[model samples]
Target: MTDQKKTHQPQPPIAVSPDEAARLAGIGRTTLYAALAKGDLPSIKIGTRRLILVDAIRDWLAQHQG
Candidate 1:
């Protein structure tokens, strides 16, 4: 019998939940939701779950930077 070890690689997330988006943005969930509601942040609805793209989060933050 031979045993094989599996190797795992860490990859950046393409999409994140609202809570995760809030955490990544260093903001509260309410603020995240407000941004989403205002269309300042982009999100997608899937099976009653809302997810934000990592790129969108980055761009949104970049847009707000002075």
Candidate 2:
């Protein structure tokens, strides 16, 4: 019998922190905050933590990219 505990797990991230979202979007922290402050980007607040959806970030990039 083979144990499944050694298997690798792969899961797609549904949400990301502002810093991580910035990194993925190739933008600075300040710019990411600015977008959030300006309501240009959408985020979900869980308690005190703010999370940005990966899908939203992609859409934002598509809208802004020339």
Candidate 3:
């Protein structure tokens, strides 16, 4: 019997940097920062670094539909 190798693909990141989050949310970095400051967009801060979750961006868009 021949051994078959299983290939694994890396999954997309669940957490992203502020710049990437802004790009994904289709808004400018300044606007995103504003929203974050206003508590509109939830963010996770780790050791003086802020990280945005992909799910949070999607949820924000869903709840802010015009």
In TM-score terms, which candidate is top?
A: 3
lDDT of 3 by residue, 1-66 (tens): 999999999999998999999999898999999989999889999998899899999998898898
Give candidate 2's whole-model lDDT.
Answer: 0.97
Clashes of each: 0, 0, 0
Ranking the candidates on TM-score from highest down gives 3, 2, 1
* TM-score to native of every candidate shown: 0.84, 0.85, 0.87
lDDT of 2 by residue, 1-66 (tens): 986777678988999999999999999999999999999999999999999999999999999989
Whole-model lDDT values for every prediction: 0.94, 0.97, 0.92
> Candidate 1, residue 41: CA error in Å?
0.4
Best by lDDT: 2
Better of 1 and 2 by lDDT: 2
| Model 1, position 22: C-alpha lDDT score | 92
Model 1, range 1-66, lDDT digits (tens) per residue? 899988888999999999999999999999999999999999999999989999999999999999
